[model samples]
Target: MKKIAFATCVHLGLSCIEEIYRIGGSLDLLITLKDEKAKDKSGRIYLDEIANEHDIPLLKIDNINDQEVLSSLKEYQIDWLFIIGWSQIAKKDVLEAPTLGCIGMHPTLLPIGRGRAAIPWAIIKGLKETGVTMFKLDEGVDTGDIIGQGVIKLDQNTTATELYKKVDDMHIALIAKYWHDIVSNNVILTKQSSADATEWPGRKPEDGEILSSMTMDETDKLVRAVTHPYPGAYYKEKERTIRIWSAKTDENDGEIKLSDGYLIPIDYEIEGNYGR
Candidate 1:
């Protein structure tokens, strides 16, 4: 098996590594974000448990492209590096450190949606179908050649949390199915077509703010797009901000009114106090 170094800082990354370990695959090193660096990033989790359990050398880094990280990768003599659930893009030096090209996992199908905040963007854009793509890392954002991909169907009611879990499962499944082929140099990569490519811009917490002018369906999509693990969609009420974690449009008796109708909030929070 090839020497593998994994870099990740979220649940998806953890799931992939765990799946690889479960299949008795070898991991040479584990790299993750430093504690202080993960404060604002949603879904960030400590991967220490997996590293400790497998006795893999764990390196916490603020930047994946730093010289220290490059040095470490060189020291380990890594053959392949899998970077999942990490926000930063690896520079050329770091990407080249591994004997084989670095690999990245994106939530949406490449050559379609190829940038940040893929989950929220998918919902906000009213995409009925999105998929996960495992591709080789190149200079451009998510422009690498595809190694594998799996389709995921989306409904009007698919919340960010639900789609998140599906994407996570797909990440693990991809690693489980392809690790052997990757290590053995038997995997084929298909180049992404530029003519069909589209990009999603990174979303901010303030993007979750709900406007009174928005219709019920728009409000519902925003609520579902940023709920739970991501920031909750909110509306400012006088001196307090009401965060809507979940909502349904079937009821018209709800307190918050939209342009078209009202949404019955399934879950909400006001100044840290959770409510229904």
Candidate 2:
């Protein structure tokens, strides 16, 4: 039986871990972080159940690259390390420790949307199609050889959260469909071309702020890109911080001049002084 190691930080990681267990493989180790503000209860309990079901030794590492983490991974004699949604960067040692090396799963297709918030960035930029990729980890951020990829269509009205679910589904399918091929080394790996790849800088909370002077379509995309599950786009209105949760852009029939970063509260709620 192939011995595999699983590392993750959020719900995405939890799903992968479960899939690994379902495949009847041996989990040498399971590494995860504690989420302080989990909205879903099943996420916490699900991880616990999987750990118990597989009888896999579990490690709660505060930092991904901590010395203890490296020591624990080495102790397990991990053959493959599957990483999902891990925030911390994997050091050279941990990546190299696994016999078949580590695989990093990204929500966006390689050589295109490479960054932390791929889904949101893609939607905000009005991308018509996006997908997920599972690749071999390398020294650079998301600059890895592609093992497998799955694509999804993006509609004009698609919200970030909506697009996120499509990517998540694609991710789950890819894992289940190709886990065997990956372990047996039957999978085809392709090198990501540097020329066609575009790097997207991850978004900050402030980046979501819509400029008043921006066109209706641009503002609409921004609004949807940061809607529920994500921090909604916001702007200052007098002394209050208003967060726009839902909006619909309409064509301006008459002359209505507005400045950049204008707070047009079509539909919003006050997020307290700190902006939630």
Candidate 3:
């Protein structure tokens, strides 16, 4: 069996992890991080679960490039490394450690959205369609040779929560569909064009603030882009900060506008967990 290594976070990493196990390769090593905020009854990330069930070696780290991490990874003798939901950019030294180098599964089509919060950024920019890509990792942020890609359509109403799931499904599908072709060296690696490469920084909690001058359509997209699983877009009102879980651009929609401007939010009430 060809030995392989996996790197990713637990909660969001399942889309790739479960399938990797199911595909039946020599997943002898798994590297992950501890998420303090995301919890479950089992108190284990999927990485821990997979390691326990399959007897795979597991490494949890704060820095993927730390000397200590490098030391431990060397023991795996891995032929390939697949990084799914890892948040940091892999350093060149580490990226070169794997015999075949590392593969990063980006949620957006590369040479376009190549940074943190690809889903939200695409939606906020009013993109009609955005997709996923499997690429070979390089020193630069997401500037990798493309292995395969698939598209997902979006509209004015696409929310971060919904897109998150769709991206997860695509991750699973891409791996299933292309694992053989990728591993056997039967695939083509398309070089990314420097002229088309785009990179943006990750989003923070404060970055979701909506501006008062945006058009109704723009504000609506921003709200949906950051709703639910993500921190909702909001603006300060008097002494309180109000978070917008959902909004609409259509004039005929049931949302009653209390005020009007280029784009301004109105008051409304919501019920239930509302997709918490």
- Among the numbered candidates, top TM-score falls to 1
Q: Against the true structure, candidate 2 has what lDDT?
A: 0.76
How many residue-pair clashes does candidate 3 contain? 0
lDDT of 3 by residue, 52-86 (tens): 88888888777778775667667877767887766
Q: Against the true structure, what is each candidate's TM-score?
A: 0.88, 0.86, 0.83
The reply for model 3, stretches above 4 Å from the true place, is: 34-46, 249-276
Per-residue alpha-carbon lDDT of model 2 for 80-121, expressed as tens digits? 788876667898887887777898888888989787688788
lDDT of each: 0.87, 0.76, 0.75
Alpha-carbon RMSD, each predicted model: 3.3, 4.0, 4.9
Candidate 2 residue pairs in clash (backbone atoms < 3 Å):
111-197, 211-261, 212-261
Question: Residue 186, candidate 1: how far off, in angstroms?
Answer: 1.0
Candidate achieving higher TM-score, 1 or 2: 1
Error of 1 at 173 (Å): 0.7
